[model samples]
Target: MYVRTSEVRGDPARLDEGLRLIREEIYPAVTAMDGCAGMSVLFDRNICRVVATTSWRSEDAMWASTETVRALRESAERALGGTGGSEVHQWEVAVAHHDHPVPDGAHARLTWMSCKPALIDRAVDLFRMVALPQIQEFDGFCGTTLMVDRGAGRIVGTAAVESRGAIESSRDAAAMIRERFSTELDATVDGVEEMEVAFAHLHVPEMV
Candidate 1:
């Protein structure tokens, strides 16, 4: 798996518009291309920063996909460059270590779900009480954890799953859970987006 991380900044008024374009135009083009495994996007309106990522089966496959997206790349370069706050980097998936083994032939989906600050506690609770049980039983289900930005009072749900199919299916599963938990755990869940990515392991060299 390979990681392509892009950092971007745009005018406040155009934030939502830019994100929409990336989701609808840029990402779909990349993900539908050959060799593309998975992808994820994250944005913070307060800070006007965005992080977009995607994974590929191999470095070759990644390049193959990008090679065909020349126009898109050029447009992004023009729109993103010289904005005084934009960058993109590519990295190899080097190493992965985990207390629990990932599912066979499985991939990871990193989602930065954001909702109203008032809904944070219940949102977390909803996942813990309702979402987890259902999601844990998914065939390709891996696991999930939350990263709460205390200062911002925003929550980030970072999840790892087996495949794109699993991520999509989880929605129905979550809906069922929501049906049960909505009364007690209803939240203004503005968005629950998904991104698939290859996980890379990073480790230090050992003594010879």
Candidate 2:
């Protein structure tokens, strides 16, 4: 699958409007396209950012569909305070796995760890040795990123799984972490937030 991911930063006050537009307007345009598979949009109140992810059948198909929505795309750019507007980076979805339900070919899983400030290092070490290696070894495991926010005392690890089975069998991902990296018996996984894609479309195709 071909994937496109982008982050847009704007005034916190305007976030709700932005999200509404994405959900109500932008996404519909994409879902109607031929090659479009699925999309999800994430808004981080703590960080004041919106992340939009979409999957497509091919790079050429994505571009062909994109050309049909130039105006709507422009509005999103204006929303993000761009003159020429920003473009999303295209990525090859070599492998993806997730706990949440995904399309036939796509995969996704989000693991969250909540811990006290003191145990932050332990969490990082655990992820490095246990979690990372297991995900890396997966047949379609392409790459993974570990996000740490010391200011908020939050550590979030994101693993891009390679296939549907990899995402479905996430217990193994947790087991790997527990076996190799669980330094704090008290450390617990608070929740696994399911993700959804966000697509946008303008009311008038000609309106910018």
Per-candidate total of colliding backbone pairs:
3, 19
User: What are the per-residue Cα lDDT tens digits for candidate 1 across 39-62?
Assistant: 655555554556666667777876
47-76, model 2: which lDDT tens digit per residue? Answer: 445667666777787677656655665666
Top candidate on TM-score is: 2
> lDDT of each model, Cα atoms only?
0.53, 0.54
Instruction: Compute each candidate's TM-score over C-alphas.
Output: 0.43, 0.49
> How good is model 1 by TM-score?
0.43
Worst 10 residues of 1 by lDDT: 199-208
Candidate 2 segments exceeding 4 Å error? 79-87, 102-208
The 10 consecutive residues of candidate 2 with the worst lDDT sum are 199-208
Q: Give candidate 1's whole-model lDDT.
A: 0.53
Give the per-residue Cα lDDT of candidate 1 at 157.
45
